[model samples]
Target: MRSLAFTAMLLAAPTAAQTAPEAQRPIAASKIVLVGDSTTAVIGGWGPSFCAYHVTSFAACVNLARGGRSSGSYRAEGSWDLALAEMRTPGYKNVWVLIQFGHNDQPGKPGRSTDLATEFPANMARYVDEVRAAGAKPVLLTPLTRRMFKDGKLQNDLEPWAAAIRKVAVEKKVPLLDLNVESSAAVQAMGEAAADRFAQLPPGSAPIGPTATTEIEVRPMAQPKLSFDRTHLGIEGANYFAAMVTRELAAAVPEMRPLLVR
Candidate 1:
C-alpha cells in the first residue's frame, strides 16, 4: 500500500521543465505600425530592416507604407482605413503608429501633391487625431531627405515639408522623429559620391539635374521593377537608416526602448 501511494504522489507532481514555458511567455505583446511613402515601404525603404532587425519577438512591426503615397492620397485610397483597423485590433498592450510622408507630397506629382502651407499640416494633424481616436499612440517623422547634392553640398529641397511636419507635431503635442535633419546631416557628411552607394542600383549615366529632386514614381504591380535612384534605398542604406530610426525612435518613445534592438 505504501509503495502504491508513493507512485501516485510522484505522478501528480510537475517537473521544473513543465513550468518553464509559462514563465517564458511574453509579458505584454506590443505592435508598431509604420505609415508613409516608398521611403518607408518594404522593397526600397528602411521600414523593412527596422521591422525585421530592430524589433523583438514581443512586438509586431507592420509596415503599411506604399510607394507614391502622399498624406492626402494615403487616406483617399483606403490605406488609412486598414491602418485604423490595425490600431483598433485588441490584445496589444500598446500600439504605436509612425507616420512619415512628404516625398510624394512635393509639387509636380499628380494626384499626390498637397499644398505645403495648408493641406499638408491639416492632413498630418488629422492623422494624429485619428490615431488617438483609434486607441494608439502616433509618432510623427519628418520626411527622409533626398540625396541630391550640388557644388559638393547636399540639397535639402524637402526642408519646407519637414518644417510643415514639425509644426503639426508641435501643435498636436506628439512625439517627433526628425529624420530629415538627421539623414541630411549624415548624407552631407558622406558627400554626393559616397551617398550613391545607398541607392537601390548604381547611378545612371545621366547627370544629376535640378529636376532630380523627386523620385521616379513606382506603382504597385505584379512584378515591381526597381531601379537606382537618389531616393529609394538599397540593403546597405536600409540598414544604415533603419539603425538611425531605431535609435531616435527609442528616444522619442522611451516605453519602446526595451522592445527595440537599439
Candidate 2:
C-alpha cells in the first residue's frame, strides 16, 4: 500500500508541474524568429526593437536576419541554414518565422537579386514550406519600402516585388504584412527631409564610425551604422517599423497575437 501511494504522488508531481502558470512553465509558450535581409537585420532593420519591446515573456524572440541577403543569397550563403537550425530547437510551445525580402531582390544589387516574376516568389514559397516542414509557422512580409521621394510623391520601386510576395502568400495561405505599402505611406507623411530620421544615419548625427548588422545590436552598443548603408535604419526607424510589424502580426497571425505585449 505504501508503494502504490508513493507512485501516485510521483505521477501527480509531473501533472502539477504541467499545469503551472505560464511564467512558471518549464517550456515557454512560443519563440519568434526573424528572417530576412538588411531591412529585417538588426543594425539596419526592425529585428532588434521587435525582439526587445514587442514580445511577451511567454515568447522568446530570436533575430537571425542578416544584411545584404536576398531570398536567393540567404540560402546560398548558408545563413538560412543557421536560421532553419534555430527553428528546429526543442521545447518551445510554438515557433514562428517572420520573413521580409525585396529591397535586395530588386535591380542594381547583383548577387542578391532574383528574377522578380519567377525566382522571387518561388523562393518565398519554398521558405514557407520548409518552415512548416521544420514544425514552425511562417509569416511573410512584403519588402519594406525604401524611404525615397521624387517631386511630390514617395517613389515605390518595390511594388513589383511586394506584389510577388503577396501572390505567394495568398497561394500558400501564409500570413502577409504589407510593410512596403505601410512604410512608404509613413515615410511620405514625414516628407523627404524628415523621412531621413528613419535611416541608419538619420540626418544630423555625426558618423559613429562604421558598423555591421551582426555586431553592435548583440554586443555592446556602437555608434549607429549599417556599414555601407544610410538607407537602412536608425533607432527611431527600427521602433517605428517594429511597431508596424507587431500591429500587422496581431491582425494577420492569430497565434502570435496573444503573445505580443504592448
Candidate 3:
C-alpha cells in the first residue's frame, strides 16, 4: 500500500504560463480565494498549479487550505477565519472563493468528518453564505476523485460529498465545479498502465528512471501512473487536475473567462 506524503512547503512564486489562450481582454487584479483541505490546498494540492500556472495574469490567488482537515475541522482549526479575513480585505470586491473538501470529511476520522445529516451540507452552506456576506462570490467544487482502480476500473469515493456539494451549490445558486466527475473521467481515459506515472515510486526509485526490466524505457509523454493513495497529487498530477479546473471555471463563470486561457 502506498501512503501519500504531505510534507511540502508552500511555493508562493508563480510559474511561467503554459498554453494560454491566443488573446484575452485584460482583467483587473482580483482575489480568487480557495478554502479547502490538503487536496485543494496550495502546498500539496492543485491550488498552486491553478493559481500559478493555469490562470492568466489577471487574477491573484489566496489559497487558505490545510492537510488532514474536513469542512467541520477546517473551520474549527481556524482556517475558515483566515479565509473570512481575506474576504474582508480591500481590493477583493470581485473576489471568488472556491471551496473543496470531503476526503477528510468521511466518517472514520474524528473531528474531521462531519455528520452528514446536520453538519456536512450545513457546513458548506454556511461557507456559501459567509462568502456572499463578505461581498465575494462563492463557488463550491466537488471533491476531486481519488483515482483508485478496482477490478480494472477507476473508482471514486467522493460520491456522497460530491452530491452534497451539488445540492448546496443549487440551493445557494452559486457556481459549481464538478471536479470529481471531470477528474475521474480524465484519469480513466489515461488507462491503468499509463496512469501509474502519477503514482509515487518506491524509495530509491526514480520517477522517470529506467523500468525494472531492460526492455522497457520510460517515456516522457506516457501518462505518469498515480499510486493507490487516495489523497494528494504529485506535481504532474496536480497540474493536470488544475487544468481541468481552470478550463471549467473559465467556461462556467463568464466573468472569470478573461482571467483564464482556453
Compared with the true structure, all predictions reach lDDT values of 0.93, 0.85, 0.79
TM agreement with the true structure for every prediction = 0.86, 0.82, 0.77
Over 1-262, each residue of candidate 3 has an lDDT whose tens digit, in order, gives 1232322322433444543556775545788898888788754578878888867666778878887899999898788988998888885438899999888988899768788767899999999999989898999999988767887788787888899899999999999999988888887888756555554453245345323545457544434333345456667767888888998898778899877755
* Number of the predicted model whose TM-score against the real structure is largest: 1
Candidate 1, residue 9: lDDT: 96
Residue 48, candidate 3: how far off, in angstroms?
Answer: 1.0
Best by lDDT: 1
Query: Of the pair 1 and 3, which is ahead by lDDT?
Result: 1
**Could you tell me the lDDT of residue 118 within candidate 3?**
75
Segments of candidate 3 deviating more than 4 angstroms: 1-27, 200-228
123-232, model 2: which lDDT tens digit per residue?
99999999999999999999888877789688888889999999999999988999888988888888987877777764565666645576655765556444323368
Angstrom error of the Cα, residue 222, model 1: value is 3.6
Among residues 3 or more apart in sequence or in different chains, the pairs in candidate 1 whose N, CA or C atoms overlap within 3 Å are none
